[model samples]
Target chain A: MHEEDRQLVRTLIRGDAAAFRNFFDDYFPRLFRFILRRVNGDEESARDVVQSALIRAVRKLDTYRGEASLFTWLCQVTRNELADQVAKSVRQETYMRRLVDLEDDPQARGILESIPAGGEAEPESVRQREDLAALVHAALDYLPSKYARVLELKYMEDLSVEGIAEAMGVTAIAVQSLLARARVAFRDVGETLLPSLGGNW
Target chain B: MDTQPDPRADEPPTDDLARLIRRAGRRPQPDPEMHAAVRAAVEREWSAHASHGGRRGAMVLGVAAALAALAIGLSWYSLHPGAPAGSAEVGTFVAARGPVHVAPTDGHEMVVAGSRLNAGSSIETGPAGYALLTVASVAARLGPGSLLKLNRPGHVELVRGRIYADSGSPSAPPDALVIDTAFGQVTHLGTQFQVRVDPEAMSVSVRDGKVLVSQGGGRSITIDRGQGLRVSSDGEVSRLNVAPYGANWAWVSEFSPNFPIDGRPLSAFLSWYARETGLTLVLRRPVTQADLDRPTLSGSITGLSPAQALAAVMATTQFEYDMTVPGELRIESRATRGAN
Candidate 1:
């Protein structure tokens, strides 16, 4: 794993544009989802944090020693960026104070309670579903990139077995075998990591 | 790895696990525009590192070039002791506004904060441009529509427009500032003064201390504190009394160097406010030295004029200020005020 990441870092530092695009496409979405969940699905804040982190990572690419996988290192950088963003927001307390005031107001609370929740699903079920979705994404992040990518293509993209094979550059039989292992892996990891969300599975 | 193959292997499982896996796909993704912006920024950084063999190497080259320039400047200065100072860094721009440009060589570049300004550089301010620079030991503030050439440390040529120079306090002044104009040369004697060069006349206003305006042929006139001297194109001179602090000096206060108040005491901020406004700071009775030095400030006061910054900083403390007296800022404890 370290050797593979070392090769990727070398390609990135050599200014291989196509290699950079592949690296970006491979990691950016995963990191984005990782941060989005943590930021309570604030897409703008997540984007800002991830964008700054990725740029910072690229600028400091030569420092990658391959001691950890490239994704893990990127996550470390993203965490720092997120921490800085949180600090800046805390320092600008006017907005935070307004939010606190709104939360404290009984009239505002009454108005919020009066508004009907969206969608046909009950609010609790919707929240549970959202939490389960976030947990699944987190579990996928922990999986090997190949396992995560294959699963995403099959389920989220609704890609056929042949399509998954084409995307992964493998034979259909290999795709099928990977999918079987990926599913088992996902279930095992999810059950271990989040029993509440993965209890039924 | 428990690779337990079920009978339903290689097929889509119609179990709760499959539903959850599909739900993960619905997780929020990044916005397309934001994604593209990030990619562009990353690629740009990668290209910079690739082309320059990393920023560290580029920084080394920058430092090496700066050292070589310094060496050449030192050699030139040593060879000609009586000549103007060699082309070396003499000051740094502390603050700038609007379209301030510094022509260090033949071409001009937009001035940025903390940029080193070398000797022989010409600074020009646009109609809305205002700049505050610390040249050597003096702080020079250039107003809009001005063109000033830095000859050397403590000396500058004012081609046109207005410039204010503060050589610090009279008790312990820095290097005296000399402003050469078309009419005559105005040199400060450890003072704070404003020099304005118009098409028809050049005027020197002394806000503090005194300055000597020298016409050619050994003729000179001393302008005392609170006095202004205007010399016409034909060498006609007129003197007038000008207030040290008023609307006339408001523009100078607008572009004053920002006093970083974080972790600084209230007394330090008050002193800065007094100096910037040319007002005498007076702590009224009951406001002891300990009271003024007790509270430490936090946060920034950037982008505010001197007066506005003072008000904002004072509001965070238990002190109240009164500017009712002309050219005096009286500060007292709020508790003292309430008791009175």
Candidate 2:
């Protein structure tokens, strides 16, 4: 997959139109899954977020400085657009306020309730993985913007430390330090929010 | 909780996990539809750029065609002003455009196509195999291996390679033309001039009037007649000279009898002036700095040809000067020459 991505990047830089087709064929499913996690399993919002990221990648094609691999840069762009979507959603207050509306419809609430809150669930082992995932998400919310962004790009986007450093315009050491701090903070939050996941680790 | 292992410790197992987490953070796979959309966008962009190239090419070709017709008409007019038909053919051959304005040292001639000169046009081949053209309205520097084309009297093109022109010769009879080098277009006026163009250094020397030097990259220089400037390949313009008018043309020819001067040390003054003018002033023998200092010189560098100017300077000064070749000049202390 890495070798294929590198080839796609080389082709794109040379202005090959077909390379983007291959890129979409190879990476779209994974991109959609990443967006799904951020959007709390809302298929529609996740799809919209992924589409918007792809569109932005098209527009900002020329500014690709090649300091980071194409995949890492694309992920950064995607994350920025996702953050913007979240900010937009927050500003509109439509999503947060709609939680009350969900209670009135059990059918709608089922999907919402299925994804547990910050805490509170049974001791089922199968649900443990999902709970841990939820705890990870909750901890991510508590991180400062800089640390969270570095952590997301490093872990979620799979960007190299060198790539993250280039994206953030900092030295590799700074990125490494931020990542270390972010990991500790995340682990602390996870231990507090979901003791089961913490004990396993 | 506090006893949790550091996730980012440099220890092997922790480091491996960190690397794995880093890998996981990369962007997910792109969707098929998204890839198609991006490719479509790129194609559209490339096609748009190609069309722009086409339109620009058409515009250039149109302008060239119109100019070529005008050139042919001018050649016909010059040849057959109601005389015999055959007389017009003598100067009617087409001159190819080249990257250079001056003829090469190996006997290549630059063609000037249908240009009108409103004032003085002086062409001389000087040091370093470059041609210096000082016309009344234009000052041009023609580099080696170039062809200069002047069309419709005012339009000049440096065909093969490089030329520097301070174009704007003078208000003409609707048909005056001059071009020194292709790098910049110049129209001459009653202007003092010096132009130095070689493959390495291309410049325009302005003696008296104004010249507008414009290159392809939108780089331009507006030079008053007494100044000299250079336009580099990257479309950057640099001012080369802004001193006295004599200082500009001093190196184009030998130090003529009519070199202007104030009372300064002869050796020191000439040495400084020669350095600026690209002239070689050789001494017959080594002399003390004292002999050169306090040797006040007063002279007029006007109206004399270069050789006459040197002779005049020699007769007046306590020192004497003579030229051995067009490139080399020798100066000796008259007191020293007589004493020796």
Candidate 3:
């Protein structure tokens, strides 16, 4: 670590609210955007993961050898949190898989089809769904955080133009213009990033 | 949905990503409350890190204070050699009535009130004897003729008698304090409750919070504050609704610890009184809870029972308390109490 970076780390250890607020304000938007994509746009889970990651990072500061940037360290911590979340959700995920498999039964399918899981009988299909969710998440990850966030809030979270404007502290008109540009950029990048899970788009 | 047309409406040239973006829409902004909550949590961590330099070095205020007290006592250990180690040094005991007998479960000789007992110790009270003890932060009173086995740090077993316990946190799922009984096991979730064991059955009562009674096999039920239940040796269960306060708690008064009220707020004293008596705290009009928040008394009401303590503490302030309901305590202004 550079001497300046070390000092910054020291300031973080001081545990002052103002210093923390400054750090949180600086990194939260970027972290939130990153997590939102990975969790398939589930806002609550994304927020939980982000909070856990940052808290863990703050506690483990002594291990910071400056081998990687602080942001990279945080991402590494987030990856671990994601793995834990994945493990915890195994039961629910299995149930979801069962629902998907039973989709062929009409009486049962009528009840289970709305479960929104990957195709049954094909383990590959399950992997594809998981991978596609990850691919889209990574694609969003590669975009400018703001553009990716707007697209996610719109499509993934189903927020309105006015709602997005209020969140971004911009006018509805500005949001639309950003959305138009973001869509073009996202398509440009997503084409290569997307796994070939029948890339109809 | 976008109300305005795409800025590049005329140039319809590119890829599927634009469609995807338009479809993916706005990412949900993190809730503002979550932002504050996480920031507060992280700030606590940062402060701890800054204070101690390492996680192992950090101890919360209560634990640190307790350890300091312990270190001071251990310093004098050299003067007193051959003292038996306390297997589960659950807090000290205060004799409330006739002599309280305490000895290791295997020992025949019983010691006096000042004597310390270990986890495997057996505590017995004579016909008129009463004893008060604290295990961790939990407060418990052993009624007259009661016998309890100090099994260990996390558990106390009722051999044959009644025991009143108040977890004292005023919250549910309190620290672990398991009360093992013949019919089953009884535990509390931060409650003021009582458990009695007889050869034929076990009875559990709640005054303020809750108690969990597990019977033989897998049967268990939660008895909330102001409720009571009985489990027969034959595995039958019956529930009863009981007053939160009154004579049922009178025996506990004999074992009430000397509460230090000097320089404490009236509210603190009142809360102690309510918990000890198992009544709801209801402050009368004109004597709001705020009135009790300020320091009122500078003298200790030491040695006074919970009821007597309340009287002494209330006399100084303008508030007077009475039981409007068996379970509810109404502490109104002196004027209001007098009027009714």
| Winner by DockQ | 1
lDDT of 3 at B278: 69
DockQ of 2: 0.05
Candidates in order have lDDT scores of 0.72, 0.46, 0.63
Return the interface RMSD of the candidates, in order shown, one decimal each: 18.3, 15.9, 17.3
- Model 2 lDDT vs. the true structure? 0.46
Mind giving the per-residue lDDT tens digits that candidate 3 earns over B1-340? Answer: 3446566632342345445544444434565445545655655656655543332211111001111211111000001011245455755555444423454422213233444556666566533446677766677888765778787776888887788887766663464688998888997778788887765577788887777888767888999977989787677788988777775556676557666777778888888887777677876577766788975678876556566667777777777677757678887777775787
lDDT string, candidate 1, B98-133, tens digits: 434454432212334566667766666544456678
Which tens-of-lDDT digit does each residue in A96-163 have in candidate 1?
A: 56557777889979866765677656566666777777788888887777788788888878788778
| Stretches of model 2 off by over 4 angstroms after superposition | A1-7, A65-69, A89-91, A97-104, A108-127, A131-201, B1-340
* Error of model 3, residue B267, in angstroms: 1.7
Model 3 chain B weakest 10-residue run by lDDT? B71-80
Q: By lDDT, highest first, what's the ranking? A: 1, 3, 2
- Model 3, stretches more than 4 Å misplaced? A1-201, B1-91, B105-116, B170-175, B335-340
Each prediction's total of clashing residue pairs, residues at least 3 apart in sequence or on different chains, is 0, 62, 13
Regions more than 4 Å wrong, model 1:
A1-201, B1-90, B105-114, B171-175
- The candidate maximizing TM-score is 1
